[model samples]
Target: MTQTVPQTTAGADDIQEIVERILSAAALPPIVQAGHPALRQRAAEFDGQLSRDQLDRLIGIMRQVMHEAPGVGLAAPQLGIPLQLAVLEDQFDVDPEAAALRNRSPLEFLAILNPRYAPLGTGRASFYEGCLSLNGLQAVVARPESVLLEYLTPDGAAEQREFVGWQARIVQHETDHLNGVLYIDRAQLRSLSSNAEYAAHWAEAGISKAREGLGFDAGPAGISLD
Candidate 1:
């Protein structure tokens, strides 16, 4: 017999309450913080039928949570939904070197649906990483500095793009959420340290090992450990 996944509904009040809690929390919520049990249990396929109202609300709530927590990206799973969705914002001001590496205008925010990602190469770089879910902890995790990704837009349009530098890292980080993985799961113990310590170490080193493995230089300002 073929297994079948249950269809689920996205409720307004329920999701709104979670969003509010996330905004008010002193820190980012734990992994799978809010949303319906179905949302947390397992997400259904997108079916290319999200209403504008639904998309708007999800975007608004995600934006608020990201602003409050000051993270570069968030995934539906972070909000307790297993959907193949995410939002990303590059808030840092661009440095010339960073911009050249990305080869795209700085993006304010992006909404992704049903994403597929592939590393550009086998090489990896080490950067201190943190998550809203883990709260007050950071670690040095290896990630690809560049990747090629394909995903759907909120409107169901197919989108394919290559990301480099910080953008690539951000995409990889969020995509991990879709697969039930966190940065900490891939972190190195010695590399995991306080934000200040990580900063001092990176400054002393003057270049991120993460970028070097990818054949690039350090990120514009380096990855924020906060």
Candidate 2:
């Protein structure tokens, strides 16, 4: 039986408002596009131990930016910070059963710090991928269907976890940002086509299986609050 979590009063619009405020308030530099050298250069250290107040502020800002942009993920560098941090929101309204099969949740967000990733076992999955930085492009990228991650939490506690399916893919993409890498770097030559072309390719190749396999039949999934 699928379990459903109670819906909260929070909505996307509410989150968007917070994001706009953060963009206006933050002294972030403009977003660096896909080919920018900075996107290739490794991000600098976050410098100094993060205070609770500062970590909260960064998290809040990331949440706002992500909401306004309506993206699956966002990174500190996108917000003009050269730090090893990022936020991911995997909360699009999608089929839950498909999500479960694909190892994904409908709407979940994560704040990752100084993350490191490794393949979980073997086997690889190819999926069409896009990025907030690239905006108008999509490509087929091959990645491990599952992975293990180690990272520090916002509170500076160590955490380790295993991820699979779309969730694992999303984590890999975002962790690349922390390391200053973009999906385009790993994009397949033929998959580097336009969005429409890539979508068609993905459909023909059963890439959508990952989405259809994810299960949202269970109630709302829980996110880490720590």
Candidate 3:
């Protein structure tokens, strides 16, 4: 589970040095942590050059890596590939109240290419969120509760879909990567906490309790987070 986030941006020479250092790991693509150039630069629409078979293989590998991270969703930029693609799924069998409270539910694995989204309604919600690239951390991110989206399937068939609750949040999160935005960029910094701390102390407390305890609503003149 250990990974490194390069402290400084790399130059062409630095990239060569990095490549030489990890030459043995050419096959298994590493999930690039935050601070890498790819995670910051907006991704491009997928070039249709890769044949369907090649695209399938690429998607397969990405799926395997995503599952290994044990994350519900992942984007192409996370793997250092600047393409508009992402995959995600969730199980509805988690605690009912918890799932309902957090707007999470079962969802079949889905892949999205060249995705775009617009608000579905005026509803907004806030819940703690995490990212694979920004591992070990969680924070409260406020986003629209639902969205209308357009994206391509793996086969390049265009489609429109509507999503609500946690599903919408996941979609927004992944698509944000394609636009060079991380949850942290929109997160309530006061709510930041280690995943372990969140699970141990905040998970069952409910969002309001969690927010109060984490100083999420504390203004500049309010209670100290520490």
Give the C-alpha lDDT of model 2: 0.65
| Superposed Cα RMSD, model 3 | 7.3
On residues 42-152, what C-alpha lDDT tens digit does candidate 3 reach at each position? 666765744576567667777777778777788877877666778877754677787878778787889999899898878888877888898899888878899998999
For all predictions, the C-alpha RMSD in Å is 8.2, 12.8, 7.3
**What would the TM-score be for candidate 2 when compared with the true structure?**
0.72
Model 2, span 113-218: residue lDDT tens: 8888998887777666788788768766778888999987787778998888888898988887766677866665444556675455434433554344431121
Q: What is the TM-score of each candidate against the true structure?
A: 0.67, 0.72, 0.81
For all candidates, the clash counts are 2, 20, 0
Better of 2 and 3 by TM-score: 3
Per-residue C-alpha lDDT of model 1 across residues 35-140, encoded as one tens digit per residue: 3353323343455334566666676777777877788888876777546678999766656764564442556789988787888987666556777776666766
Let me know the TM-score candidate 1 reaches against the reference structure: 0.67
How far in Å is the alpha carbon of 70 misplaced in model 1? 0.6
Query: Which pairs of residues have clashing backbones in candidate 1?
Result: 125-210, 126-210
Considering lDDT, which of the candidate structures 1 and 2 is the better prediction for this target?
Answer: 2
Overall lDDT per candidate, in order of appearance: 0.63, 0.65, 0.74
